[model samples]
Target: MFDHIQIKVKDLKSSKRFYTAALAPLGFTVQYEGGGAVGFGPKGAPALWLGEGDSRGSVHIAFAAKDRAAVKAFHAAAVPAGGKDNGAPGLRPDYHANYYAAFVKDPDGNNVEAVCHKEQ
Candidate 1:
């Protein structure tokens, strides 16, 4: 298991705004903000970290949703917050029978996903 993951962005403020809106539905919030970096996750944990700088390359980060509805909510919330739709919410039988999820490209063009591994 990973303790945390960090990504670099061109603009901290803009990326912060995007993530603030995008991750809300999945129950993640800004956990810490200091040293020109922002941390997001549950109340006290920071699973994802964003720092201001040039992003060398894109990365895919999938967040676990409690259920299918939460996955849908994450997609709905992410789009208007500056995310581009990559994959609509649905089952990926290839990945698995119950791989219900959605994907969006973040401001930095990173693949962000919200997935529920359980059948609804």
Candidate 2:
């Protein structure tokens, strides 16, 4: 339903590194980079855009993962890329019976998350 999202970060390079690793496990990659911003998504479409600036406020974004393992992988990748662990991978029954997810705070303090809802 959403066309794309743009997040403002204090440092462009650092945000790039954090996102590159964190999203890799979920099959997202940098699709374009120029004009002081970078766009990430599958093959050709860039759904997430990171721009250089001082963030007015922290943003929360959640990507869909194929399964639980992908959620775990995203957490592992995020930590080393300057992300702080917001939540470990687990099934949140409160959200629903099969709501598996993980959360991380990006370098710019954005709340990033990956979630899987398929039954397994």
| Among all candidates shown, the one with the greatest lDDT | 2
| Backbone atom clashes (below 3 Å) for every candidate | 0, 0
Q: Which segments of model 2 are wrong by more than 4 Å? A: none
Q: lDDT (0-100) at residue 54 of candidate 1?
A: 89
Clash pairs detected, candidate 2: none
Model 1, range 1-120, lDDT digits (tens) per residue? Answer: 899999999888988988999899899999999999999999999999999998999999999999999988889988998889999999999999999999999999999999999979
Q: On a 0 to 1 TM-score scale, where does candidate 2 land against the true structure?
A: 0.98
Candidate 2 on 28-68: residue-level lDDT in tens? 99999999999999999999999998789998999999999
Task: Evaluate residue 116 in candidate 2 and report its C-alpha lDDT on the 0 to 100 scale.
Answer: 99
Poorest lDDT segment (10 consecutive residues) of candidate 1: 10-19
Every candidate's lDDT? 0.94, 0.96
